[model samples]
Target: LIRGGRVELGDARDLPFTIKRSWARERLTPDVHPGGFVLGCNMTMHRDVAARIGYFDERFGAGGPLRSAEDTDYLVRAMLLGIAVEYVPDMTIFHHHGRRDRKAIEKLHRDYSLGNGGLCLKHVRH
Candidate 1:
């Protein structure tokens, strides 16, 4: 069985957060890894759980509207299918956290809206 989770990315000045496991869910407190859960870093090719889960929803892109909830959809579906999500704070990755200007923002909104709507149609219409 594969377990996965999500982590928050912080700025250089901010302390990176770690993933905390829910003690209540453990049958017996594990010694090897005290935390019953596992790691969840963003877009790491080697250890990313999505290789077992699947790829990003192509309906999402930088300038797309439906993009915001793509990750939420994946994580929710994984959980519903009984996949475990753990938070791993020790891992670090670099991401481009660029600020978009008004035009970029507008494009993203429109594209994401179209992409999300397209996803709904493709998945539900059949």
Candidate 2:
């Protein structure tokens, strides 16, 4: 939408990637590596994983004060705890966000940036 066109999101974020399981399942701190992100709207996980991570941080949710990055925060938390986190392409959901205009998309980007900044600060503080 910010790019000035019809935002057909079918392939907007999905990209071909190769992920290798880390032999040493240990981490010094939480980090969002490449291929570690998944859309919150389409996020799916085993009940155990959810229970382990203690669920999404509402503070980072789109409607919350942070305004975005709940999914990324969840993923990073899982990784830091040594819980498996992967991006599964086959498991998909059709999200019709209807952001067909530049103004809407630009706003979305701005909101996302704000949320991302908050997320970073949260992690750094911890």
C-alpha RMSD of each candidate structure in angstroms? 9.1, 9.1
Q: With candidate 1 superimposed using the best TM-score fit, by how many Å does residue 112's alpha carbon deviate from the native? A: 9.0
Ten-residue region with minimum lDDT total, candidate 1: 27-36
Off by over 4 Å in 1: 1-52, 61-65, 100-126
Q: Model 1 RMSD to the real structure?
A: 9.1
| lDDT minimum window of 10 residues, candidate 2 | 1-10
lDDT of 1 by residue, 1-126 (tens): 333334343444433333232333222122232122443234232345556667656555443445543543454445545555444344434433442356665655665566556555644433
Native RMSD of candidate 2 (Å) = 9.1
Give the lDDT of residue 68 in candidate 2: 73
Judged by lDDT against the true structure, how good is candidate 2?
0.55
Clashing pairs in 2: none
**For every model shown, what is its TM-score relative to the native structure?**
0.41, 0.69
For model 1, what is the alpha-carbon lDDT of residue 34? 18
